[model samples]
Target: MSAWDRTTSREQVLTRIRKLAEIGKISDTGVSRLAMTPLDRQAVELARQWMKEAGMSVRLDAAGNLIGRLESPVAPDAPVLMLGSHLDTQPYAGRFDGIIGVLGAIEAVHAFVSEGLVPQRPIEVVAFSDEEGCRFNKGIFGSRAMVGRLEEGELERVDGDGITRSEALSIFGGDSARLDEAKYAKGSIAAYLELHIEQGPVLESLDAACGLVTGISGPLWLTVELHGFAGHAGSVPMSMRRDALAGAARIIAGLQDLVRAEAGTPAVGTAGTLQLFPGSRNIIPERVQFTIDLRDMDMERRNRLEAKLRELIDEVAADNGLTYSIREDTNSPPRYCDPELMDVIRLEANGMGLQLPELMSGPFHDALALSYACPYAMIFVRSKDGISHNPQEYSSADDIAEGVELLYRTMRSLALSIQGERSGGKWESTTA
Candidate 1:
């Protein structure tokens, strides 16, 4: 335990996260720091200041990823051991969703400095921007830029206010014209580790403090539009009216049933957003557009489920005498955590007497983008009631502290392993 003041470190981490939460405070407890917003910039600046205070060199990448680097004294040129997550929040989001991972990395670095210890490999903490995709309808913007996966046309995509992503990047101090510079060369990152709250109930249900993520479920987002005919609500009889909203409602219910029937598997579906044209009490909706977000750890199963959904939508639309169109907005494949890193995390959890069950992440994360650049892993602390992306989402302070401690230990172990391999020695286990 290298003389690390656990209590003080925990307090500091919590205090910083709380301060950032205030930047975009909504209502009594929600957060709304959308990507590239003024509050988002404030949060990034605050994180940069904290990184500097922790004695790390800090800078923003071309895509506006706030990076804090702690160079290793023994192996400065070794591939960087990266630690990060996003800072942007969903509309009225919880405080912990992406905030903890970035701040937790900083706390880990501060602990090393406080203990007069320099890791064997450099550690870099990154706070990625626009992970929620709330404004631009595209997630993992900064991370995709880092891996050179972002297409140039994506910059032209506009937000609700008709602001292009390119313009938003400029506002965030990121030059989309120079986005290529943000790409990391292959093998430059040794591994990426992120700590986040389990936005699901698995951990809390099992009475566990934290869990090691096995993989992140990929999502396929589709905008389904049903077109029928608008009619006077009182004048059109239920049997004669071809109401698009009614047809959409039936399809949404079918989707829920489909997922429920796929029990024992990781498959899930949601009709998160629905809009009705001619939204009036006196008129039947002629057009209904709804978003379907389906996810599964198994790609095959996910695809199968998607096919079934398409069939259901078609059948429902036909039965209701409505025309239907389905457009795939985005598709991200499932990403598995590195098995070797999973082993390291398991060993540490057992050594610390922490309950660390393996779990799959239903929500997508920045790690999915970073996976293209390097091996990645995630640690999830228990979220109360398995809730997130809302004001009620909560993770206890003690649970978050445990997660931070695990992250620190994992980074330290990886650093040492990299150093050992460089010195003509086999990597040694860091567990007792």
Candidate 2:
């Protein structure tokens, strides 16, 4: 309110991404920029040009993560103030998800050059690869390797179409063989920050422009298979017919009831995908399979839900004379952001006269994965509604720019603080 003017001029970054959308540069489905695809390739190249245009050196790592390095007044090897977000998006996904963070970092660099604001440590902006997990079932592939967490077996995970990880890498113009090389030495990085759109309607509903992430919830992908005998619906008596679909239908209803009854206040579950076998009107359907997606910030609750689901699946399957099996396709533990860094983010936002909410993230993101590797945090900007991963997803240019301003201030402050430490100097903790 007091003449807020510390914000950087980063309209160009927003303009560039919006321009990409205006043209056929984006996919037909509102947001279809999958990693390593032609669109992702174009996006990375654009990032490279912007990095140079912003007066920073640019390079790509083995895992296809793009980096732009800006020098600081501190030592050449000063602990870097790394900021990043992914460039790839979900099929027909929204514009802001991970794209904003990457370009916003570029905007931060441009701001430094334009305003002649030099911090103590160098700043490195990155665009991580394969964050959406649309093409590859595994997500945060780039960040996982960055943290030295990708086991060798993961390299063997073939995609849906029988494309090996190595082949997919080559198709994307990167070497899958060298993904392990993407790992960095522990403590080599000083800190990391990311900016993303709040995929939920929380901020927009609350009329807040910016939100600080306290934690990101874990996601559990589950597959439930129910098997029973195929038979004629008219001839086979209810007692004689082994109705798999019937059993599945009952369990599906039960699954919803269980979630509604026991789920943590805000926790939810979705049986998004379902398949019935042998589409014949008369014949009783034999096999039924469906997908379950469970999300929660509390790991214990997630585990409990999973356990209860397994028991329910077994009980219902056996009660109806059906065969069934439960397997956890994938699960990531909940990630908590650095509390001290979060405080600094809040302080910076308040100093800038921006209102913010301390919120937990419901969606899984690359930032959650990277938190394990660094003192990482995220800033969530308001979305039009709670809608994301669709073409209708939107945020105003002014709001986007405001978040960029916050990103810049927090990053610069961190760099200067690190530099101050290395030089045996002190930063005056100037919030604004």
What TM-score goes with each of the models? 0.88, 0.87
Best by TM-score: 1
lDDT of each: 0.89, 0.78
List ranges where model 2 is wrong by over 4 Å. Answer: 1-10, 22-31, 151-173, 239-241, 262-264, 419-432
Candidate 1 regions exceeding 4 Å error are 1-3, 158-164, 227-247, 275-288, 317-323, 419-432
Residue lDDT tens for model 2, 187-281:
66777899999988889888998899988877899888888999877888887877888888887787788779863355678888989898689
Per-residue alpha-carbon lDDT of candidate 1 for residues 56-118, written as tens digits (9 for 90 to 100): 999998898999999988888888999999899998898999899998999888888777876
Clashes of 2: 3
Residue pairs in clash, model 2: 31-92, 31-93, 201-386
RMSD of each: 3.2, 3.6
For candidate 1, the C-alpha RMSD (Å) to the true structure equals 3.2
**Where is the poorest 10-residue window by lDDT in model 2?**
1-10
